[model samples]
Target: MKAFLPPTSYEYVTVHKVQGDDVREASDVLAAEEPLEIRVGYGPVGQREHRTISITMRTPGHDFELVAGFLLTEGIIRSRADLQGVLYCPDVQKEEERENVVRAELSPAAALDLPRLERHFYTSSSCGVCGKTSIEAVHAAGCPRLPPGGVRVPASVIHQLPERQRAAQELFEQTGGLHAAALFSPTGELRLLREDVGRHNALDKAIGAALFQDLLPLHEAVLLVSGRASFELVQKAAVAGIPVMAAVGAPSSLAVSAARNFGLTLCGFVRQQRFNIYCHEWRIS
Candidate 1:
């Protein structure tokens, strides 16, 4: 049987559509965005401790995958073995808020680094040299430099990715406001795809799905994002061991720097059958 999934889009809002003096009232579909509180349950059998980890604004579907990907990319839980289970918070009294919260139970053997986690959240919320500092911290967190020559893709394949990803975006076709992240085989076959109002959240859901399937260290995969590449997105891809990342839009300067530092192949403006390889060009054939 297919698993039950939550709704990812909403259509309750009515809007006025005016085009060339042709105005009419129409119902519109929107990519659902809601706050998800991620809680972690840790410690030994009889001395378990539960703590709220983060609350992020995200689309409603794939909540479990989002939590798993967030934990992995944040350097919280290392692997699937570190996770005991992920479930909705049943104690939430209001029915509507029940699915809005999720808990990831950690194995007793999994070490909890509260200080590092706290520092991560702080840096994320701050400005200034946080970009440079965050990149350095990723190094400090033991995100390995991607090994050289393990994966390669053709420029022809890269050229076709954006269109393929867009075609698979069911929610985006309806709302036209969702960002997407997808994992593809080196040969350009789409493996997993996720959509969200937040770019990073979409990536987390995709990576989280891979994690649940024990597909981490995605050394042979190509990651494609529907929007511009950012530092956070690059960092998350590097942490997940994705070798090559391509974006339909431009990449920030810091994103290029991080990709170079992490030895990841970064591609930007991947449309019109052409793209710019910001770093690690050898990965593209």
Candidate 2:
């Protein structure tokens, strides 16, 4: 069908014709960026040789933090102690096309819990404990009980995030489309923001940034997304131990369920002057 066109293909329509109808033209071209692979290593030299733990296509920056956060969210390294240092794959940094990945070097004693991690091939982005061989494994990992008292933000405060998030988007304004995830303090300060053509990748970048800063288990924080909340996103928040998630759009049914299941507060459809409390209403005043 004509409508099912590739991103690079642009079509034309007459928007304002001198004689007949007007024409408009547009295309689905997405910004192209590098995809990175994260590897786990345990050798005397650290990251000299290792096996790939996960592969994700990402925007071309923050490669080290991405490796750190990916390993963390995947439950590979619980704390920084398990990791030695993050480095570029020797060949990747040397090559122009393959420079997007970083290897997270682990201590020789460090490793993924084999019998526990082998339940299934980890899905593309379900970073929460939901994708384990058994739900019991999550409990075993000491996922940690989140504090029930969470950060509270007024609806008025929530309403301003969409516009604020957009205003900081340097790359998206040019591309006309991309996703962003930003961390905001309880009092509405913009802590950090990361953007990517993919919503998941954007979130990964944001999480990666936070991980690099030694900010894991964001129990006292709030996460705001440029778009709707999805199952994968809720899972991401869960792994990070973030207490609340707010989106400028709606939440998927699965995402809402995951939030409730994990005791994370979820808010959605936030714009201008209103927002929806998808899971916990108590978190919003």
Candidate 3:
């Protein structure tokens, strides 16, 4: 199934390179990056509206999932019921128009927060809403402290995720320029894996897949990231109701605080059969 995804997600580039002490021409694979404009359509019956919510650079594949996950975590739409449909805005006048812009239509009863959407204009995939004054803002936007006793995972299962995640990162193996996020069952079965040039985009793609699959409130899964855990990563996991987050790299100070505040089990340096649990230790056994 992974092979069925779009191959346009990466491109081969010719480069001037050095081989040992000799200069040589080289061709390398690069993860494709392009700007995606996400728009929202919501209001009341017979009063439908549309507005551009954000523009961020991301890889070319899994775009619908990316937009869905972004809207879910941003508190724009609560669940699948709130989403009417996701479509690429059709503009016959341009060739790239359909590929570059995504529009999410909402159900009639779903209220659009205009101000919140306006604030989202400043967000980028690299640092999601990082300029906000406080973490409370995120909480106010609908992030909740994850309920405890959600799921318990064996230590051995947790140790195997990185390898499993790597097995799915075909683009990363070629370019080494992408980040990945994989979702695993409580028993450690790998469920979904997504990769993007941006770490946040990768996580969003993973969450979006779950959202589309009617797997929200991810209380029975662990999210494994290929890189450091950032505050946005924890926030996204909390919004999606994922109980545990494991990263192959270290976590930031804000990520640790957000995990503790939101009651998530976060583990870092997950390699060599040893991992450092930073919060919610009860979930690991």
Candidate 4:
């Protein structure tokens, strides 16, 4: 399916442009950025409890997918069955507030460790997890190391992804200010794409789309991002069971380290018909 392009993804604004003393007023399109509040309802059937979990800045669209992806990657919920329902907050009075807020109801059978989640947010907000601790936390969250040699992608297929990813980024082409995450087949066909102001949010949207379609543990797929690969992105990929990840930009030191530890094949600077494989090179033939 083609990527869903939300009308709210961009806004038109009047701007002044100056080029070497030549100045003119023109209309410009900018990628829209807004805060999204994610809430969750859990517990027994009638005695459910709700809590506001996160408020993140994102381009408004694909809100449900973003929430679903966040829950799974964070180890809050395991599979699609864990999500009972997802909807906008109906109790909010303001229409805009209602649009900004989303609540995901979890299945009663889905276990929630509130204390651990609380600690996670505290550490994430306070100073961020250290590199070593972050790797350990992935294991603690039950993300297994990827097995080797299940999927092999040709180098030519890898070379074609950046261009395809760019072509599929409709909002970025219009606004020149959004990050994109895409899933591709091993043979290089685009399966899904999502764009957002935040890189992580974009990836979450893509992964969430896969999750909603019951396509998790994306073992035979390749992931491509429009920006540099970070430790967090690598961790998300591993958690999603994606075996290969490629980035148009560079991969950070910790990202490479985590990919090696997780046995994920990571490729960076994936443009100009060339790329660097950080670890598990056997997956890229």
Question: With candidate 4 superimposed using the best TM-score fit, by how many Å does residue 73's alpha carbon deviate from the native?
Answer: 0.4
Following a full C-alpha superposition, what root-mean-square deviation does model 4 have from the true structure? 1.5
Q: Give the TM-score of candidate 2.
A: 0.79
After TM-score superposition, the amount by which residue 31's alpha carbon in candidate 1 deviates from its true location, in angstroms, is 1.0
The parts of candidate 1 lying over 4 Å away from their true place are 1-5, 120-125
TM-score to native of every candidate shown: 0.95, 0.79, 0.92, 0.96
Task: Report the lDDT of model 2 for residue 63.
Answer: 62
The all-Cα superposition gives candidate 3 an RMSD in Å to the true structure of 2.4
lDDT of 1 at 176: 94
User: Candidate 4 on 1-285: residue-level lDDT in tens?
Assistant: 456676787899999999999999999999999999999999999999999888999999999999999998888988899999999998986777868999999999999888887775422423467778888888888789998669999999999998899888889889999999999999999999999999999999999999988898999899999999988888889999999999999999989999999999999999899999988898888
Worst 10 residues of 1 by lDDT: 1-10
Flag the better candidate by lDDT, 1 or 2: 1
What are the clashing pairs of model 4?
Answer: none
**Model 2 agreement with the true structure over 17-69: per-residue lDDT tens digits:** 24457554544334456667777776565445566656676655556666776
lDDT, each prediction: 0.89, 0.69, 0.86, 0.90
lDDT, candidate 2, at 274: 77
Q: How many residue pairs clash in each candidate?
A: 0, 8, 0, 0
**Rank list by lDDT:** 4, 1, 3, 2
Choose the strongest candidate by lDDT. 4
Instruction: Between candidates 1 and 2, name the one with more favorable TM-score.
Output: 1
Tens digit of lDDT per residue, candidate 1, span 2-49?
A: 123356444558999999989999998887888899999999999999
Instruction: Looking at model 3, report the run of 10 residues with the lowest lDDT sum.
Output: 121-130
Indicate whether candidate 2 or candidate 3 has the larger lDDT: 3
